[model samples]
Target: MAMIHDSIVKEDVVEHKLGFYPRIPADSIFTRENVTARTKLRAHLNTPLHLATMENKPNSIALLLSMGCRLSYNNLDMSAIDYAIYYKFPEAALAMVTHEQRAKEVMALRSDRHPCVTLALIAYMPRVFEAVQDKCITKANCKKDSKSFYIKYSFDALCPQLKMEDGNNVRRKSENVPKSQNIPLPALNIKYSFKFYQRSKLEVDALRLALNDPKYRPEPLCVINAMVAHGRVELLAHPLSQKYLQMKWHSYGKYFHLANLLFYCIFLIFVTVYTYLLMGSSENYSHTKKAAKCNLSDPMTFDRENKTEKNNVFNSDFESKVAMYTSTVAILAYNAICLIREAYNVKQQKWHYLVDPSNLVSWLLYISSTLMVIPTICNYFEEIQFSAASITVFLSWFELLLLLQRFDQVGIYVVMFLEILQTLIKVLMVFSILIIAFGMAFYILLSKVGPDETGHHLSFNSIPMSLMRTFAMMLGELDFVGTYVQPYYKSETDILLPFPMPTFFILGIFMVLMPILLMNLLIGLAVGDIESVRRNAQLKRLAMQVVLHTELERKLPAILLEKVDKDELIEYPNNKKCKLGFLDLILRKWFCNPFTDDAGLDLVLESSEDYITAELEKQKRKLRDISLVLEQQHTLVRLIVQKMEIKTEADDVDEGVSPGDTRVVPRWSSPRIRKKLRTASSFNK
Candidate 1:
């Protein structure tokens, strides 16, 4: 059956992919053959969840979900969610993510972590981190541990605590460990403080599944650090993320953040002026010295041979030189500040700081800026200087857009643009295979019968050339004289169509399958996905804004880093009481203390669990009421059928049917007739 002609099967009622089996939302058991355990429905389970995603009906995903079909089967397992996401089905993926979140909330009961944060920790963070943590004991126990700055600092922080609790048991793990290590431990700071946040096995498993299974969860927005490492404003949206966000910094500490921006702006201004000096005017190289180096005592001659000495406008203009000098100084200062700021953020935020796309984009621009400096210092290779500066300047605009994302209105659209572009590229990538196959096919056919004796191969000369021709043809650029006439001209007015059969088939297929038919397919897929894409807009915007804000917040003046308020610092999962009293300090000495501040120290988790439980209970009650109503309606329907039967029996008697004749009506009261001796009279009444 699987190998049957697809065309013949399409002629059947079920082959229309969109809305077939309208009543049966999920696939039925395909087990008519053997009717044994091996031939069960489980083996061939198909689901509308799979259908909805592949069809780009993300809007329909939730609708299908409401139909109560099993989401996880061999055909559509948890990874299906990721497949949807990878193919740009954001809404469908969102539905899957939300379902996973709900399931976790129900299962975990009172787990304090946000689903998103839990997800990020599991998905975005290196899987290697767990292994790294496991080996930290051996690393810390190394004989030369004290030689490293971080190891020494972290040991000093961990030494003050003598006892620790692991679940139901309390262990004095800290007592046996060295208190004076020198290595700069990966998770520590210059302040020599260490706060170990714990995650349960269940949470870790959930996160792990989220990364591997499509149905498990969505990717953390732009792959930022988990909320535990640092904070993004977007994390504030979810209770779990909010907890992590609160644990991290709440605000930019100083006006120096503004100063850094101004510095970059100053750098850009200088770069623009330098670009103008290099490329803005013509014949300005006349006054410059003709030397490999910019500084020399010689007459400047810039022509075809000595092009390197050309465009030295800075040599002639005093202000351009001043701008050049000032810009160089600004660039150096900005680079140093950015580098230091990033390092500070990494120390405070942990490994998550490096995962941000915005940071990566900034790094590219910074590197470009740094490269431009080499040319600037030598005061040579003006073209290279101009080229590098232009690229840096363009990328800086993107960085600006990233920064502007802190503003909601602008951020939302920019986020939409980024996602849309990403999705479009993915869409184009799908069609690339067909494009390449067609291009290769066309190239082979044309190369076989390419060009006249004059060797005028219009597009058949090379694969790239044929690909461009095919692409142009797809865009309605078919050149008869150039493509066909020049290549296959038999004589002045007569021309033999090269590989007429292949040409016809190739062109026909390319036009029909790709440009005409396949083009519509692309449009349908994209259009189908638009609503699904729109569904994720808010979360996507939040994710982008968080990235931008996190970057800016890190650049605040050094003085402001120490002025954090205790009130603002209090957030979920990571909340702790300030140790103001001597007793508070004393309580921290033993990890075995029953009233450990780290455990259940906040009411938020408990309250959130209660709210979720109450909501679930409320829904269950409503379903119970609905079931009762359905039962009553069923009883009413049975009574109506009985009444109709009794009426029909009476009509039969009036029509003078034979007395011994039996009515073939379905038995409604066989037991009632048996119980009553005076059957006719009693039944008539």
Candidate 2:
């Protein structure tokens, strides 16, 4: 019966038509011969149908009626079958009967001897009724209200035009036919069936079956859906891209550092060369002075003979020409050195060379070189004596002016104390020269008086004669001075003083030793200058150290705070755990300590808890220290402000008073305040 029903469904779908069959007894058994007969009948009718057993006895009549099937029995309680046939298969009903008559017909059919006849009738009849009822139900539910019913066939008959080696088709044919024969028969064409089952498993299995079956296979909807869901993809480099960005930054940073190193090296070389040249020239000058002294020419005789031989030695024209050429060379060298140094400074971005020792020395040499050119060339013009005294004074003035200019540029208050030391040295040098000159002049003037009542022996006859003899003694022409005047003044009758005339002359000679006095003064000046420079340098170094220490102190707390915030350090992962104790770790890592020991590590371990607490306390201490430093800085700033105010007030007071008028002294003691301020500043440094 199942085979017959399946065959009926296939056949009915192919023909696109409906079929109906009579109901059967509930206890009836189905057979193969019945199935074959039903299959043949479906083939003959060219229609598809299905069979189903009704579960509810009362609804069986109603279900059959809704399905539109005919009654095939009488005297078999046929009222149910009649009602089912008339109601469900009104168009499919070939006959109808009452219940008693239907029951009698069913009993007679049961006694009749037709092979598989009952089974065939039962299988095919229900299927035909079901197919008709389904069509009617679908029509009733369809909003379009379709007028005709059609059957969807199986693969066999539906695709007749789709010729394949294994002949199979799954489509339907047209159910509508023309009312008149003149309409002409429409040509039948094969069309594929696209059916959807309401059952989920049926739809899935249908897709799987279609994919597996070679002959009826079609591309499944799932394949296209999957392709759209996951398509072309790509991989990108995140870490490598970041590394490339960092590499660019490092390259630029390295280039900048290299450029800085290059400039620094160039500056170092220039300073070295400049210092060498200046020192070399100074050494040469010292050697020249020594050579001049060793030559031992008589200055007095040289002066006298030089005046006599002046015209013979050099014509005025030649002298003037030599002076002119020397002056030009000196001017050119001076300007060239100045321009070159300026250019170098501009290139190096160092506008202030005064702060640099090498640069200062080089500049001093250049000044000396310019000054020496005039003196050296003056000899070529004999009339100009090349007065060292006048040149010294000029050079002193020049140096003073340069120092003032430098002080102005650097700031007056900053360099004023340094200038004071320099000025003191100059004053001492000048005073020493004057004292030596006065002593020599005084000795010469006092030598004229013979032994007086006071027991003073003055052997010279006249002051001018004594002066010439004094000069002669000074020049080491002692015999000429003594022989020329001593006999007349030093006869045995002449009273003799306690000290001999020659002893006084020897004492005058000591006073006339300019080099010794000059050397001592220079030594003193050099020592003072060095001390001042050292003090300034020490102050600057201390200031820098203070700043560096302060920065380290400031940065340490931040680093410690950062470490504290990363609480993972308290219970670090085993792989990352340090073997050392906290103090040892901090000393080694943070303080960059080189040494480690078991004892020290034990100490660190013992103090770990205290160390953490101490670190927090240290952080607070650092904060307090910073606040104190800030307060000190603020106090210093206030002091500077007060100092400035005092200075301004002093200047105002001075401005109101006339230069010749007696000025009133301010009650405030600025010098004492300044000393205290300086002491404070030194402490800070």
Candidate 3:
């Protein structure tokens, strides 16, 4: 390896044809096309750049470039920077991208290199990601004649197992071995006329890559999760990203919706029925007993008691039957299935899975539902059973509501709700101290008070209760008379309320701050959050749609996936029209206009006129640049021809002056013809 590198670096002799057009002799031997050549500790068909990048030698790369070593990609369609990104060597990649010559000229000219955006994102190399963007799109690096780019990043090949088997970047059979990289994607045309283009200020190249590819290709779920995790939420609003997500939605999204709907519907029915039967039967029997006791003096009391006994007997009979147990088991089984799916995702996505709000909520619901059933099986107290059952029911229904957001038509509302809720929580977090202070004050003031005429205790007797009351007041539920006035008036004057004036002052402040100022501020923030969500509703919906589609794909059968999978070049708006089959018609009708309408799909792809115009402008720029280069070359050739002609004329003049001619040059013959020569000859004679 050292000898090979030394040979490449030391061979500095240049051969010139016309004293100006120089070519490096070493380029012929150590050329980009010569891949079969091997060296110690280097893989077959690897170049010096590949070796340098693999070993993380930035200086060696710099020296090789300075020696006129072209930054040509090897057989893998990978440039030196690609190899650096693949091997997780950010410094080496940075070195290559930061080099003036390599970055501006070589990288610009070589648009065929594998797309490094996905790899950089996956590796979380922000600096390298930015550098690559600068190389590809920045004004200093983009050339007019640069090729139209189409990056076919293949996610199927990004698996670690495939990375190892595909020996495109592996080392030779030696002590050292090279590691690997991830992600595959479709072609994206980032080339645009520089006149109309400007680099984006946002650091969201990964999300742009995810959504901006020219081909409406589906990326892996992990990539989307990475975007969210890294907070590239701003660029999700790009038109291309929105269009890409719409394509994914139309692919197999309807089927996912139907499947989830069916499954959840069944689970919810079982949950509702089980909860109603368990809670209703016991409560109704107790209510009947209370009625019978109150009407004991009446003649119908004995008859009512008999009827209540019969009803209680009937309730007991049904509660112990197989039908009830069947529902319990069904609910349990549904939860178990959901739990297993969550567990599988957790195993696959690990940290990302754990952090997702939807996943966390689903886990919570599953656990609560499972615990809800345990009380019945073990015959716990009725109050405890009701408490568990009530929680389980609320969460199950709420889970259904959340699942409904998988559809774009309804997702916007859920997004708005969540956005407002998030704002409200943040506002509350900042002002929660006021609530605590007021709640503690109320607890002290009301702790000494007794129940009212209706036999209800003052609601602020405890700190938690007081806080709850204050929060309620913040929401416009202030029971002023009951909380303060009635508590004071109902108590005796002998009770000697010590801090009435101070309490009133604090109460006035609490009312002003909590109900008026803080509540209005919260409302304003909620309004702003809603507007922001509305502005970004499309992006948020697409992101949610991505998550839904990914989950659907994971749950779908392979056969169905094979049937529904899209081709590489998905022609939008006119992509195979919906068939007249029953299922197709149902899906079309169900997801019309907003999702499956042809006109709506047409909006996803850029208009042909715009695309053609941009492309033509780019071509014109390229042609102009080409003509400029050719003109310069032509002028240089003319100068060379002029110099050569002058030399030829001088030679002709020299040839014209024959040896006997003494007119023009009379060169070395002067020695014989000189006067001194004649005088010397005479002296010698």
Measured by lDDT, the strongest candidate is 3
Top TM-score prediction, candidate number: 3
Whole-model lDDT values for every prediction: 0.47, 0.36, 0.57
Cα lDDT of model 1 by residue, 1-685, tens digit: 4533332233222323346445532233233232233224325544455656666664466555554534442443323443454465544545543442232221121111222222333344322222222222221333332433112111111111212334565332212222222222111121221222222223334444534542332222222345323433333343333323222322331133344555667766766665566563323443343233544334354243255433453365667667766777777777787888777877867877677666788788878887876766766565666677778878877777665444444555666566556676887788778878888887776664545533335575688887887777776676756666554555353334556577667777787777787667766766656666577664554454455445543444323432331111211222232433443243234212112223322422335777798799899979987998999899998899898864557445656666768677656567766567567768898
Ranking of all predicted structures according to lDDT, beginning with the best and ending with the worst: 3, 1, 2
Model 2 spans with C-alpha error above 4 angstroms: 1-333, 336-446, 449-533, 539-685
For candidate 2, the TM-score is 0.19
Q: For candidate 3, lDDT tens digit of each residue in 373-427? A: 7766775435666777888888888888787666666667877887787778887
Q: Model 2 residue 329 lDDT?
A: 63
Error of 3 at 399 (Å): 0.5
